[model samples]
Target: MEYEKQTEHKHHHVGYGTLILIWVALIALTSITVTIAGISLGSYTLFVALFIAAIKSSLVINIFMHIKFDEPIFKVFLIVSGFTLIVIFILTFSDFIYRG
Candidate 1:
Protein backbone atom coordinates (compact mmCIF):
# COMPACT_ATOMS: atom_id res chain seq x y z
CA MET A 1 0.00 0.00 0.00
CA GLU A 2 1.33 3.42 -0.94
CA TYR A 3 1.11 5.98 1.85
CA GLU A 4 0.12 9.51 0.85
CA LYS A 5 1.88 12.45 2.49
CA GLN A 6 -0.14 15.31 3.96
CA THR A 7 0.15 18.49 1.91
CA GLU A 8 -1.26 20.96 4.41
CA HIS A 9 0.96 22.76 6.88
CA LYS A 10 0.37 20.77 10.01
CA HIS A 11 1.67 21.94 13.34
CA HIS A 12 3.31 18.92 14.94
CA HIS A 13 3.43 19.28 18.70
CA VAL A 14 7.06 18.89 19.66
CA GLY A 15 7.65 17.84 23.26
CA TYR A 16 8.78 20.80 25.34
CA GLY A 17 10.27 18.74 28.15
CA THR A 18 13.81 18.72 26.71
CA LEU A 19 13.64 22.39 25.76
CA ILE A 20 12.45 23.30 29.25
CA LEU A 21 15.28 21.38 30.83
CA ILE A 22 17.86 23.08 28.65
CA TRP A 23 16.42 26.54 29.36
CA VAL A 24 16.37 25.90 33.08
CA ALA A 25 19.97 24.72 32.99
CA LEU A 26 21.04 27.80 31.11
CA ILE A 27 19.26 30.06 33.59
CA ALA A 28 20.82 28.31 36.57
CA LEU A 29 24.27 28.56 35.08
CA THR A 30 23.81 32.22 34.25
CA SER A 31 22.62 32.97 37.77
CA ILE A 32 25.60 31.21 39.27
CA THR A 33 27.97 33.08 36.99
CA VAL A 34 26.43 36.40 37.94
CA THR A 35 26.64 35.52 41.62
CA ILE A 36 30.30 34.73 41.22
CA ALA A 37 30.92 37.96 39.40
CA GLY A 38 29.66 39.79 42.47
CA ILE A 39 32.72 38.57 44.32
CA SER A 40 36.13 40.23 44.09
CA LEU A 41 37.64 38.34 41.18
CA GLY A 42 39.48 41.33 39.70
CA SER A 43 40.25 41.13 35.96
CA TYR A 44 39.02 37.55 35.57
CA THR A 45 35.47 38.71 36.22
CA LEU A 46 35.22 40.24 32.73
CA PHE A 47 36.26 36.98 31.09
CA VAL A 48 33.78 35.00 33.14
CA ALA A 49 30.94 37.36 32.24
CA LEU A 50 31.77 37.14 28.53
CA PHE A 51 31.93 33.35 28.68
CA ILE A 52 28.56 33.07 30.38
CA ALA A 53 26.96 35.53 27.96
CA ALA A 54 28.29 33.55 24.98
CA ILE A 55 26.91 30.28 26.35
CA LYS A 56 23.52 31.86 27.00
CA SER A 57 23.40 33.35 23.51
CA SER A 58 24.28 29.98 22.00
CA LEU A 59 21.45 28.30 23.90
CA VAL A 60 18.99 30.97 22.80
CA ILE A 61 20.02 30.65 19.16
CA ASN A 62 20.15 26.87 18.99
CA ILE A 63 17.05 26.12 21.04
CA PHE A 64 14.70 29.11 21.09
CA MET A 65 15.57 30.27 17.57
CA HIS A 66 15.34 26.67 16.29
CA ILE A 67 18.62 27.08 14.44
CA LYS A 68 19.42 23.44 14.98
CA PHE A 69 16.46 22.42 12.78
CA ASP A 70 17.05 25.17 10.19
CA GLU A 71 18.43 24.65 6.69
CA PRO A 72 22.08 24.70 5.57
CA ILE A 73 21.73 28.28 4.31
CA PHE A 74 20.75 29.48 7.75
CA LYS A 75 23.67 27.59 9.24
CA VAL A 76 25.98 29.26 6.74
CA PHE A 77 24.59 32.67 7.65
CA LEU A 78 25.08 31.96 11.34
CA ILE A 79 28.66 30.84 10.74
CA VAL A 80 29.45 33.91 8.68
CA SER A 81 27.94 36.24 11.27
CA GLY A 82 29.86 34.53 14.05
CA PHE A 83 33.13 34.82 12.14
CA THR A 84 32.49 38.47 11.42
CA LEU A 85 31.85 39.16 15.07
CA ILE A 86 35.02 37.35 16.03
CA VAL A 87 37.07 39.34 13.55
CA ILE A 88 35.67 42.60 14.83
CA PHE A 89 36.37 41.61 18.44
CA ILE A 90 39.95 40.66 17.57
CA LEU A 91 40.60 43.90 15.80
CA THR A 92 39.14 45.97 18.62
CA PHE A 93 41.18 44.07 21.21
CA SER A 94 44.33 44.50 19.15
CA ASP A 95 43.85 48.27 19.19
CA PHE A 96 43.28 48.29 22.94
CA ILE A 97 46.26 46.07 23.64
CA TYR A 98 48.59 48.16 21.47
CA ARG A 99 47.44 51.58 22.75
CA GLY A 100 50.37 53.21 24.58
Candidate 2:
Protein backbone atom coordinates (compact mmCIF):
# COMPACT_ATOMS: atom_id res chain seq x y z
CA MET A 1 0.00 0.00 0.00
CA GLU A 2 2.84 2.36 0.78
CA TYR A 3 4.50 1.65 -2.55
CA GLU A 4 1.23 2.35 -4.31
CA LYS A 5 1.00 5.70 -2.64
CA GLN A 6 4.50 6.61 -3.77
CA THR A 7 3.79 5.57 -7.35
CA GLU A 8 0.50 7.38 -7.69
CA HIS A 9 0.05 9.66 -10.69
CA LYS A 10 -0.43 13.38 -10.41
CA HIS A 11 -3.39 15.29 -11.81
CA HIS A 12 -2.38 18.38 -13.73
CA HIS A 13 -5.08 20.81 -14.54
CA VAL A 14 -4.64 23.58 -17.10
CA GLY A 15 -6.93 26.58 -17.31
CA TYR A 16 -8.90 27.45 -20.42
CA GLY A 17 -7.26 30.85 -20.61
CA THR A 18 -3.81 29.23 -20.62
CA LEU A 19 -4.79 26.93 -23.46
CA ILE A 20 -6.17 29.84 -25.45
CA LEU A 21 -2.97 31.76 -24.97
CA ILE A 22 -0.90 28.84 -26.10
CA TRP A 23 -3.05 28.47 -29.18
CA VAL A 24 -2.56 32.11 -30.02
CA ALA A 25 1.17 31.80 -29.54
CA LEU A 26 1.29 28.79 -31.82
CA ILE A 27 -0.64 30.68 -34.51
CA ALA A 28 1.70 33.63 -34.22
CA LEU A 29 4.77 31.43 -34.50
CA THR A 30 3.32 29.70 -37.55
CA SER A 31 2.68 33.05 -39.18
CA ILE A 32 6.22 34.13 -38.45
CA THR A 33 7.60 30.90 -39.89
CA VAL A 34 5.61 31.34 -43.08
CA THR A 35 6.71 34.94 -43.38
CA ILE A 36 10.33 34.00 -42.83
CA ALA A 37 10.17 31.34 -45.52
CA GLY A 38 9.37 33.97 -48.09
CA ILE A 39 12.12 36.36 -46.94
CA SER A 40 15.06 34.14 -48.08
CA LEU A 41 17.78 34.64 -45.44
CA GLY A 42 20.19 32.41 -47.43
CA SER A 43 21.97 29.71 -45.39
CA TYR A 44 20.62 30.99 -42.09
CA THR A 45 17.03 30.48 -43.23
CA LEU A 46 16.99 26.76 -42.51
CA PHE A 47 18.46 27.24 -39.05
CA VAL A 48 15.99 29.94 -38.18
CA ALA A 49 13.03 27.87 -39.32
CA LEU A 50 14.27 24.83 -37.38
CA PHE A 51 14.71 26.90 -34.24
CA ILE A 52 11.19 28.20 -34.44
CA ALA A 53 9.82 24.73 -35.18
CA ALA A 54 11.63 23.32 -32.18
CA ILE A 55 10.02 25.87 -29.92
CA LYS A 56 6.58 25.11 -31.32
CA SER A 57 7.11 21.37 -30.87
CA SER A 58 8.25 21.81 -27.28
CA LEU A 59 5.18 23.81 -26.43
CA VAL A 60 2.95 21.18 -28.00
CA ILE A 61 4.71 18.36 -26.16
CA ASN A 62 4.75 20.05 -22.79
CA ILE A 63 1.31 21.59 -22.90
CA PHE A 64 -0.84 19.62 -25.35
CA MET A 65 0.73 16.25 -24.58
CA HIS A 66 0.88 16.90 -20.86
CA ILE A 67 4.43 15.64 -20.66
CA LYS A 68 5.30 18.34 -18.15
CA PHE A 69 3.12 16.81 -15.47
CA ASP A 70 4.10 13.19 -16.01
CA GLU A 71 6.66 11.10 -14.17
CA PRO A 72 10.41 11.76 -14.25
CA ILE A 73 11.04 8.53 -16.12
CA PHE A 74 8.86 9.71 -18.97
CA LYS A 75 10.80 12.95 -19.10
CA VAL A 76 14.05 11.00 -19.20
CA PHE A 77 12.76 8.89 -22.03
CA LEU A 78 11.79 11.99 -23.99
CA ILE A 79 15.28 13.44 -23.51
CA VAL A 80 16.92 10.23 -24.64
CA SER A 81 14.72 10.04 -27.73
CA GLY A 82 15.45 13.62 -28.62
CA PHE A 83 19.18 13.03 -28.21
CA THR A 84 19.04 10.02 -30.49
CA LEU A 85 17.19 11.96 -33.16
CA ILE A 86 19.73 14.79 -32.96
CA VAL A 87 22.58 12.33 -33.31
CA ILE A 88 20.93 10.81 -36.35
CA PHE A 89 20.44 14.22 -37.91
CA ILE A 90 24.08 15.14 -37.27
CA LEU A 91 25.37 11.93 -38.80
CA THR A 92 23.14 12.25 -41.83
CA PHE A 93 24.20 15.85 -42.40
CA SER A 94 27.85 14.96 -41.95
CA ASP A 95 27.56 12.19 -44.52
CA PHE A 96 25.85 14.56 -46.94
CA ILE A 97 28.58 17.12 -46.45
CA TYR A 98 31.36 14.59 -47.04
CA ARG A 99 29.70 12.98 -50.05
CA GLY A 100 29.72 16.24 -51.97
Candidate 3:
Protein backbone atom coordinates (compact mmCIF):
# COMPACT_ATOMS: atom_id res chain seq x y z
CA MET A 1 0.00 0.00 0.00
CA GLU A 2 2.76 2.42 0.91
CA TYR A 3 4.63 1.60 -2.28
CA GLU A 4 1.51 2.21 -4.29
CA LYS A 5 0.96 5.51 -2.55
CA GLN A 6 4.51 6.57 -3.21
CA THR A 7 4.25 5.67 -6.86
CA GLU A 8 1.00 7.53 -7.12
CA HIS A 9 2.49 10.69 -5.71
CA LYS A 10 5.55 10.62 -7.94
CA HIS A 11 5.32 13.39 -10.51
CA HIS A 12 7.63 14.35 -13.31
CA HIS A 13 7.47 17.98 -14.25
CA VAL A 14 9.02 19.28 -17.49
CA GLY A 15 10.43 22.78 -17.47
CA TYR A 16 9.00 25.58 -19.56
CA GLY A 17 12.33 26.13 -21.31
CA THR A 18 12.56 22.49 -22.31
CA LEU A 19 9.00 22.52 -23.61
CA ILE A 20 9.65 25.67 -25.62
CA LEU A 21 12.75 24.12 -27.14
CA ILE A 22 10.85 20.98 -28.01
CA TRP A 23 8.11 23.03 -29.59
CA VAL A 24 10.62 24.90 -31.69
CA ALA A 25 12.27 21.67 -32.79
CA LEU A 26 8.93 20.19 -33.71
CA ILE A 27 8.09 23.26 -35.79
CA ALA A 28 11.42 23.08 -37.59
CA LEU A 29 10.84 19.43 -38.35
CA THR A 30 7.37 20.19 -39.65
CA SER A 31 8.78 22.86 -41.91
CA ILE A 32 11.37 20.43 -43.21
CA THR A 33 8.65 17.84 -43.81
CA VAL A 34 6.61 20.35 -45.82
CA THR A 35 9.62 21.37 -47.87
CA ILE A 36 10.50 17.76 -48.52
CA ALA A 37 6.97 17.00 -49.59
CA GLY A 38 7.20 19.65 -52.25
CA ILE A 39 10.35 18.10 -53.66
CA SER A 40 10.63 14.95 -55.77
CA LEU A 41 12.78 12.72 -53.61
CA GLY A 42 10.77 9.79 -55.06
CA SER A 43 11.77 6.54 -53.29
CA TYR A 44 13.40 8.31 -50.35
CA THR A 45 10.51 10.67 -49.60
CA LEU A 46 8.49 8.24 -47.50
CA PHE A 47 11.56 7.23 -45.52
CA VAL A 48 12.45 10.83 -44.74
CA ALA A 49 8.96 11.76 -43.63
CA LEU A 50 8.60 8.70 -41.46
CA PHE A 51 11.99 9.32 -39.87
CA ILE A 52 11.15 12.89 -38.94
CA ALA A 53 7.70 11.86 -37.69
CA ALA A 54 9.20 9.14 -35.53
CA ILE A 55 11.58 11.64 -33.94
CA LYS A 56 8.76 14.07 -33.22
CA SER A 57 6.64 11.29 -31.78
CA SER A 58 9.43 10.07 -29.52
CA LEU A 59 10.05 13.56 -28.22
CA VAL A 60 6.39 14.02 -27.42
CA ILE A 61 6.13 10.59 -25.80
CA ASN A 62 9.26 10.99 -23.69
CA ILE A 63 8.93 14.60 -22.57
CA PHE A 64 5.33 15.68 -22.96
CA MET A 65 3.77 12.39 -21.91
CA HIS A 66 6.48 11.75 -19.28
CA ILE A 67 6.97 8.19 -20.50
CA LYS A 68 10.70 8.47 -19.82
CA PHE A 69 10.01 9.15 -16.15
CA ASP A 70 7.55 6.31 -15.80
CA GLU A 71 8.25 2.82 -14.48
CA PRO A 72 10.56 0.34 -16.16
CA ILE A 73 7.58 -1.79 -17.17
CA PHE A 74 6.22 1.09 -19.18
CA LYS A 75 9.50 1.40 -21.01
CA VAL A 76 9.43 -2.31 -21.72
CA PHE A 77 5.92 -2.01 -23.05
CA LEU A 78 6.97 0.85 -25.28
CA ILE A 79 9.85 -1.17 -26.66
CA VAL A 80 7.61 -4.11 -27.40
CA SER A 81 5.06 -1.85 -29.03
CA GLY A 82 7.66 -0.20 -31.19
CA PHE A 83 9.06 -3.56 -32.24
CA THR A 84 5.64 -4.83 -33.17
CA LEU A 85 4.96 -1.73 -35.22
CA ILE A 86 8.26 -2.07 -37.05
CA VAL A 87 7.54 -5.70 -37.84
CA ILE A 88 4.11 -4.84 -39.17
CA PHE A 89 5.47 -2.10 -41.34
CA ILE A 90 8.14 -4.39 -42.71
CA LEU A 91 5.67 -7.13 -43.55
CA THR A 92 3.28 -4.71 -45.19
CA PHE A 93 5.98 -3.12 -47.25
CA SER A 94 7.33 -6.48 -48.24
CA ASP A 95 3.96 -7.62 -49.50
CA PHE A 96 3.43 -4.39 -51.39
CA ILE A 97 6.83 -4.65 -53.04
CA TYR A 98 6.50 -8.35 -53.89
CA ARG A 99 2.95 -8.06 -55.19
CA GLY A 100 4.06 -5.82 -58.00
Candidate 4:
Protein backbone atom coordinates (compact mmCIF):
# COMPACT_ATOMS: atom_id res chain seq x y z
CA MET A 1 0.00 0.00 0.00
CA GLU A 2 2.82 2.37 0.83
CA TYR A 3 4.57 1.55 -2.45
CA GLU A 4 1.39 2.15 -4.39
CA LYS A 5 0.88 5.53 -2.72
CA GLN A 6 4.46 6.51 -3.53
CA THR A 7 4.00 5.52 -7.16
CA GLU A 8 0.80 7.61 -7.43
CA HIS A 9 2.52 10.61 -5.93
CA LYS A 10 5.46 10.18 -8.30
CA HIS A 11 3.11 10.07 -11.26
CA HIS A 12 1.40 13.28 -10.15
CA HIS A 13 4.59 15.28 -9.71
CA VAL A 14 4.72 17.78 -12.57
CA GLY A 15 8.19 18.23 -14.05
CA TYR A 16 9.71 21.67 -14.50
CA GLY A 17 12.29 20.69 -17.12
CA THR A 18 10.31 22.09 -20.06
CA LEU A 19 9.36 25.23 -18.16
CA ILE A 20 13.02 25.80 -17.31
CA LEU A 21 14.02 25.40 -20.92
CA ILE A 22 11.36 27.94 -22.00
CA TRP A 23 12.46 30.41 -19.33
CA VAL A 24 16.12 30.16 -20.31
CA ALA A 25 15.30 30.61 -23.98
CA LEU A 26 13.14 33.65 -23.27
CA ILE A 27 15.88 35.16 -21.09
CA ALA A 28 18.40 34.73 -23.88
CA LEU A 29 16.06 36.29 -26.39
CA THR A 30 15.38 39.23 -24.08
CA SER A 31 19.11 39.76 -23.62
CA ILE A 32 19.60 39.79 -27.36
CA THR A 33 16.76 42.27 -27.78
CA VAL A 34 18.24 44.59 -25.18
CA THR A 35 21.60 44.43 -26.92
CA ILE A 36 19.99 45.28 -30.23
CA ALA A 37 18.22 48.23 -28.67
CA GLY A 38 21.59 49.71 -27.75
CA ILE A 39 22.29 50.34 -31.43
CA SER A 40 20.74 53.25 -33.34
CA LEU A 41 17.44 52.15 -34.81
CA GLY A 42 16.22 55.50 -35.98
CA SER A 43 12.70 56.22 -34.63
CA TYR A 44 11.71 52.61 -33.88
CA THR A 45 13.62 52.15 -30.62
CA LEU A 46 10.56 52.76 -28.46
CA PHE A 47 8.47 50.36 -30.51
CA VAL A 48 11.13 47.69 -30.28
CA ALA A 49 11.38 48.09 -26.52
CA LEU A 50 7.61 47.82 -26.18
CA PHE A 51 7.57 44.72 -28.37
CA ILE A 52 10.21 43.02 -26.22
CA ALA A 53 8.34 43.91 -23.08
CA ALA A 54 5.16 42.42 -24.50
CA ILE A 55 6.95 39.16 -25.34
CA LYS A 56 8.34 38.89 -21.84
CA SER A 57 4.95 39.59 -20.33
CA SER A 58 3.40 36.90 -22.53
CA LEU A 59 5.90 34.31 -21.31
CA VAL A 60 5.14 35.16 -17.71
CA ILE A 61 1.37 34.98 -18.22
CA ASN A 62 1.47 31.69 -20.14
CA ILE A 63 3.81 29.97 -17.70
CA PHE A 64 3.29 31.48 -14.26
CA MET A 65 -0.41 32.16 -14.71
CA HIS A 66 -1.00 28.74 -16.31
CA ILE A 67 -3.22 30.39 -18.92
CA LYS A 68 -2.06 27.90 -21.50
CA PHE A 69 -3.60 25.02 -19.56
CA ASP A 70 -6.80 26.77 -18.60
CA GLU A 71 -10.26 25.99 -19.93
CA PRO A 72 -11.72 27.57 -23.09
CA ILE A 73 -13.92 29.96 -21.15
CA PHE A 74 -10.98 31.11 -19.08
CA LYS A 75 -8.92 31.56 -22.22
CA VAL A 76 -11.70 33.64 -23.76
CA PHE A 77 -11.87 35.79 -20.68
CA LEU A 78 -8.13 36.26 -20.66
CA ILE A 79 -8.11 37.20 -24.31
CA VAL A 80 -10.94 39.65 -23.86
CA SER A 81 -9.28 41.20 -20.86
CA GLY A 82 -6.01 41.59 -22.71
CA PHE A 83 -7.71 43.21 -25.65
CA THR A 84 -9.68 45.52 -23.42
CA LEU A 85 -6.55 46.62 -21.65
CA ILE A 86 -4.79 47.23 -24.92
CA VAL A 87 -7.67 49.30 -26.19
CA ILE A 88 -7.74 51.42 -23.08
CA PHE A 89 -3.98 51.89 -23.20
CA ILE A 90 -4.08 52.91 -26.82
CA LEU A 91 -6.88 55.37 -26.19
CA THR A 92 -5.00 56.97 -23.31
CA PHE A 93 -1.78 57.12 -25.22
CA SER A 94 -3.47 58.59 -28.22
CA ASP A 95 -4.85 61.40 -26.14
CA PHE A 96 -1.36 62.26 -24.94
CA ILE A 97 0.24 61.71 -28.33
CA TYR A 98 -2.19 64.03 -30.08
CA ARG A 99 -2.28 66.70 -27.44
CA GLY A 100 -0.45 68.97 -29.86
Query: Could you tally the backbone clashes for each prediction?
Result: 0, 0, 0, 0
lDDT of 2 at 45: 91
Off by over 4 Å in 3: 1-13
Residue 15 error, candidate 4, Å: 3.6
Ranking by TM-score: 3, 2, 1, 4
Output the lDDT of residue 51, model 1.
80
lDDT of 1: 0.75
Better of 1 and 3 by TM-score: 3
TM-score computed on alpha carbons, candidate 4? 0.68
What's the best-to-worst order under lDDT?
A: 3, 2, 4, 1
Candidate number achieving the greatest TM-score relative to the actual structure: 3
The deviation in Å at residue 100 for candidate 2 is 2.6
Q: Give per-residue CA lDDT, model 3, range 48-91, as digits (tens).
A: 99999999999999888878777789899999999999999999
Query: What residue pairs are clashing in model 2?
Result: none
Full-model lDDT, candidate 4: 0.76
TM-score of each: 0.76, 0.84, 0.86, 0.68
Error of 2 at 4 (Å): 11
Model 4 agreement with the true structure over 1-100: per-residue lDDT tens digits: 9856764565444359867877897898789787978899976787788788888778877766666655478779988998998899799989966898
* lDDT of all predictions: 0.75, 0.84, 0.88, 0.76
